[model samples]
Target: MPARIFKKSWLIKSIFFISAFIILVIGGTTYKKIEDLSQSSALLTQTYKVNVELEKIFSHLKDAETGQRGFIITNDPIYLDPYNVGRENINSSYAELKVLGKDNIALQNNLRELNILIDKRMEYFEKAFRFSSVGNYNDENFKENFYNGKKLMDTIRVKIKGMIDSENELLRKRQQTYESNLKVTPMFLYMVLLLSLVLMFITYSKIIRDLKKIKAANEQLEIFKESTKQSEIIGQQGNWIWDIEESAFTYSDNLYRLLGEEPQSFTPTLDNFLNFVHPEDVEKLQKDVDKMMINEDLPFIYYRIIQKNGTIRHFKACAKLHRNLDGKKQLLGITTDITNEIEHFKTLEERNLELERNNKELSAFNYVASHDLQEPLRKIQTFLSRLEDKESSKLSETGILYIDRIKNAATRMRLLIDDLLQFSRTNKSDKAFELVDINILLENAKQDLAELISEENAIITSNKLPTINVIPFQIQQLFSNLISNSLKYKSKDRIPEIRIVYSKIKASEEPQISNPKKPYYHKITFTDNGIGFDNEYAENIFVLFNRLHNKDEYSGTGIGLSICKKIVENHQGFIFGSGKPNAGATFTIYLPFI
Candidate 1:
């Protein structure tokens, strides 16, 4: 059994040594290459993250300067939007860059200078705003501050550019390393195949003639029967060979075990096997077996089996016809316990039905919200408009005030209806994927928000973006909602400044995304200097109608963020929001791209 015939044959054993050495070489190469690839991937992630964060700092600083200038010229508090936004994001961007670049001494040095330049620019911006606040908006003072702030801004941009250039260089190096590993992996596979062929040739030379000389052909029949028992026992299954002419059967050892019977006690016969079949399945199982016998084709059957203890379980039987040496027919087959698999399938089926019902109910609710709820609000609003037009002077002050309250309530109801309808429709958007250029998408959203941007003197800066495969309309809706939400929550005393930028990451690197066939995701960030809410409400903000502020403080239906979340999910992406109160909110979207 130990192959003692070769126990003292060192020359023969060298073949095994060669095989092991080849395996070790192949395995060691794979391990080292994988380790190198992982490190390169991590370095690439850090490089891009640091580069993006630096751009974010640069972008926010510009927003602050723009906000300061807008407030100086128009003296509108809304112009401070970007100033407050820059204050909220600049520090966080620096912190993020520091963490991402902690391994690189040069980047850290660059970050230190970046911090100094941004601070200097911000200080001049504050002075300009301070002068304007104190009635110091003279042309000479304005020109002096303006020229100084622009100089500081230009210096900050130069420093940020240097950092970005260095990171791009690092990214290039890491990508080259990763590509080299990909090339080496194929060479490893080729070497492994060559080693396997050498081993196989050596083995064939030793065994080719000796196999015919030493082993009887009949040995296979014994081996097959014994293997059947071992396999059935391991799998909690059974096997049988039926002799068609003799009307007799041979059962594997585990066949008796499967029926909860004593081994070797029961006779192998058709009636005995049928006795174990569930009462309802007996006639069908018999009919299938008779058909398989006549047709001599492989047949598969799934039925319930009642064991000796009366517990019913699922079983799958498959059989193929064979011919004996004497030309007599035989049926060789296996049966497996499929109770657990059957139960799991049933559970999933029930869940699908339940989800179908829930979808129908939701559709009905949306219909009611569209028709029943909105019609009455429309009537109230139309009547109020008519009364206000025809009875302005005749109406008493109290009457007018009551009419105004009714109109306001009706208007609020209309807003509520619209928000609800939008929320209900979020997941129902057409799922057709298209190549959506993010630059064009952002431009459309900007165009839509053009009036508000000019009214508040808001500043929006964006970097070159990518084209992503997504539901184009849904992605456009996502951009529009995120930008509008930022404008709506802008700080009262600061100008609204918004910056959009992106970083690329591998889907396998991010733990939250699952089953990524495409390796890359573009993390597009929308940061705004507005009255950001508490971090605890980050997820809560994406729930329908979950508002952090009173209606009087912020005029929103609070469903915009929820729609943004749904759209991201529809594209197999992720959306997240985080902010500190009064600091500003950052909405980060992860969308897959080629």
Candidate 2:
């Protein structure tokens, strides 16, 4: 190769000059086309304006003539309204049309003749009116004047039509010229465009090959950009750069998104960012900024920012100072949104407060149950025992019945106290949780109530149960109380039947409870075939001292279900019951398997 175009520098310069020349030729062609279009547009607009004015003149004259004839017939002033309006508007319309046609001397003379004819028609109308007023309406002179007025009106109409026809013809010619100009002028532009494309192909043939290298560079940068954004979002962190010299801030995209905003919505300035901070926290943020400014060491700050949605979020930010070779100082920092962490801490705080309040109430209850309430019930039971053992024969039948009633009342009170103590005991027990075998627990419960189960002629059946973490004695007592309830509420016609069903389930599938972190549950349901009460009392049955039946119908301390509720709660579980009137009751308990 003697000489290559790429090696010759002058060839590159020559290509640029050729490209510039091609563009100039195309631009000149476009300009000529635009000039022709502008001239055609002006002519068309003038023609339309002239036509509109001529039509206005014709319409006004016809309206005035109608008013004049109406006045001649009815002689009413109201008929003059159309005539008055036409006379007022026609002069302005004619003046505008005449001025528009001033450039064309031939049309000027024609417009002058049209204006004179319009004036003569109105004069004839006025002359007829004067003649009719002076003489009779049907006089010869008045009839001659009205006839002349009609002839003048016909001449005015013909002249207006002539002007309108001429204007329309001009408009059509201008439109043809405009269309011809667009086609002819763009031909030169197209030729010039083809030449320019050829030159650009020579210029950028290697440039396109080089652009591949640049594109790969850009793709590498994009990988870093995407990775940075992903890391920020996952860690709930965002980076920011503050230019100390310029007092400006460059925020990463995730930083803006973290504030519930789109990137590039507004520039990140100190004051602008502070606007999203809570009012109560703004002072703290401002002071932290000052501290970062003063210290050479990187500063750490924690504060709250209110998001665009009006929700408060907590943030922890730390910044390091950086200096480029150009000696420009900036602060490169990362900020982490800790809203979820803050919310978790707040939840723990609330839970601790509630536990504290419960402890205080339990202590107060324990005090009263141990001391104040137990003394009266104990004395009554002691006196009843003394009368039964030592002086049983002296009392009459009614007295003995009264003593029995009092003794029965005392026994119920004592049982209520014991159950209340048991309910309160579930709150603060020292028993550690261990894996207890449920099959053995149910057996122990049945054995404890052997005499009652035999007397009530009841049948106890249970499916296979799971070994789960629980307080052993408490779970045993839970089964015993529920089984005893079924025995006590049994109908005379049907022998009592108690079914204990246990199964394992995912916590999400269990409708009675939800613990997403702990995914599985051990479900135990104690279903009884006894005298079930109304479903309305389903929730009410778990309340302390809540009873569905009277003592004569069913006897209990009324604290058994409340104790069951407490036991389930201590095990981090749920207890729910459903029943229908005179149907059966199902008591379902959900215990976490974790």
Candidate 3:
């Protein structure tokens, strides 16, 4: 609202009018004052000029009297020349005196008296000049005429002095008026100038105060803007900002942490932030950002991050873009960490898989127990029934013995079914992880089958073992089954040499062997020197009810390897066996560290 006020139509119009009024007042006042002063200065200048001319005329009158006296005494014609020159100057000066005296009766009367004296002196000079030309220039008569001329001239000189005094007095009075006007004009102008300055200062001070208020209002607006921006950022999980003109990027601390980074450690940039995104999701994110910036087309994105600790986390960034007043489409956005959410989703998926697997295994177990195992069991029972039905007269001892053997076969079938049930039920067990010492576990397993190992003369050797975090019972069962297999399938007269080797391996071996871009792994090997099965059955060994040999030849329920496979895989690992028909078998297990 304040921003709008500065741009108001009335405010701008008022400023323009006020500024024009001030300029007009100052300009008009200054012009009028200058005009009046110019008129006064012109009058003073004219008065000074007239006064100077009057002083020159009086000086000529005095010179003319002196020249006439000098000519009468020296009898020099050169002196007459000056008198003639002065006489000629008299008429022109008289005209000037008349003009200067236009409004002054006193000065006009003095000029008339001055003209009378000049006419009397001219009459006397003319008579003297005629006597001199007619040779009547006798000293006695000439002296008398000179004396008469002196007396008349003295009287006229007194009048000229009086006129000169009057003109000097007028000049002095005019000068005094000019000096007085000059002295008072500056003081009056200074007062007016000082008043104008004070008025202008007040006006400008008001303008500056208004400007300061506007500045303060603008500062408050900025503060409000920052507070609003901060609220928006904190409410969202993470936020991003783009300066369109600057072509730069800015992100909140949450965004950096979402990408598993420290804000202070790196500058936020589109390229830098996107680099942390999983490669599979990079193209989509880049395209979305580009479209938002270029065409104002916003898009939502969910991507994964491989954290600094090598943990996988998921994130979703969402926003919409519109042009600001400046026409820049800033990409304002929020990002949220979805690692726990993704984990929960994965757990649900895994749970579903386990349930489905349990259902399938149960179905297979029921089918196999009824069809495969029961069929043999039913035949054995039928044979024994037939034996009992036909044994009328004292049954032959051999017939009873053969019937007992058939019953034994039926009993073994039932035992196999029971063993399979036990194996399938392991999936349903909620076993928690505990520290499992492989060396101690293997020794106990060997002790359980000590009699068989001693009778077969099998040598079960183990390298130094590790205490791993695992389901202890599962690990024990795993090693026991493996050892049992080695002893059971040993070549006759060739003692079994079982070797279990465990090493602390770096998580880098055969990592890319599965998928080059996948994370690394750690491997543990269990190798045995015994009669190995065919390579074709290597994968099948871990299948329920799958056997490499007939039931009559090997003593197993065919669930041992399957149980071992399940245990290793539940820990996010892989179990695979490699063997030649007669050489030996080696099972290598791989598990991720994180």
Superior by lDDT: candidate 2 or candidate 3: 2
Clashes of 2: 0
lDDT of 2 by residue, 1-594 (tens): 112323454666788888998898788878878988898888888888888888888898888988888888888768889998999889888789778988978678888898789788888878877865664787887888888888887787787787778778778888888888867877777888988998999878745654565577678778988998899999989899988888788999889988989986897888899999989989988888888878743577888898889978888899888995457998899999998998999999999999989988978979799778999778878989999888889999998999999998888888878888887777626788889887898999999999999988889889999888889888988999899988888777788899999898888876667544468878888888888878888899999889888877788878999888888888888888988656678999888878
* Candidate 1 lDDT tens digits, 1-594: 123333434544687678777778877877887888888888888888888888888888878878887888899999999899898899988888888888899988887887787777778887887788886677687669878889888888887887788789888988998898878887877878797778968866766544543354437656976886688888888888888788788987787887778787789888988999999999999898788778765467988889888889888888888886557999888888888888999999999999989998998999999999988888888888899999878999999999988887788779888988987887844467878687898898889878988999998999998887777777888888998899999999899989998889988887866687578889899999999989899889999888988998788887888889988888778888989789799998888766
Count of backbone clashes for each model? 10, 0, 0
Q: Return the TM-score for candidate 3, rounded to 2 decimals.
A: 0.44
Clashing pairs in 1: 79-495, 80-494, 80-495, 81-494, 81-495, 81-496, 82-495, 82-496, 82-497, 85-529
**C-alpha lDDT (0 to 100) for residue 70 of candidate 1:** 84
Candidate 3: regions farther than 4 A off: 1-399, 506-508, 511-522
By lDDT, highest first, what's the ranking?
2, 1, 3
| Best TM-score among the predictions, by candidate number | 1
The TM-score between candidate 1 and the true structure equals: 0.57
lDDT of each candidate versus the true structure: 0.83, 0.84, 0.71
Kindly report which residue stretches of model 1 are placed more than 4 angstroms away from their true locations once superposed.
Answer: 1-234, 243-248, 308-310, 320-331, 428-430, 508-519
Question: Hey, what RMSD does candidate 2 come out at?
Answer: 32.6
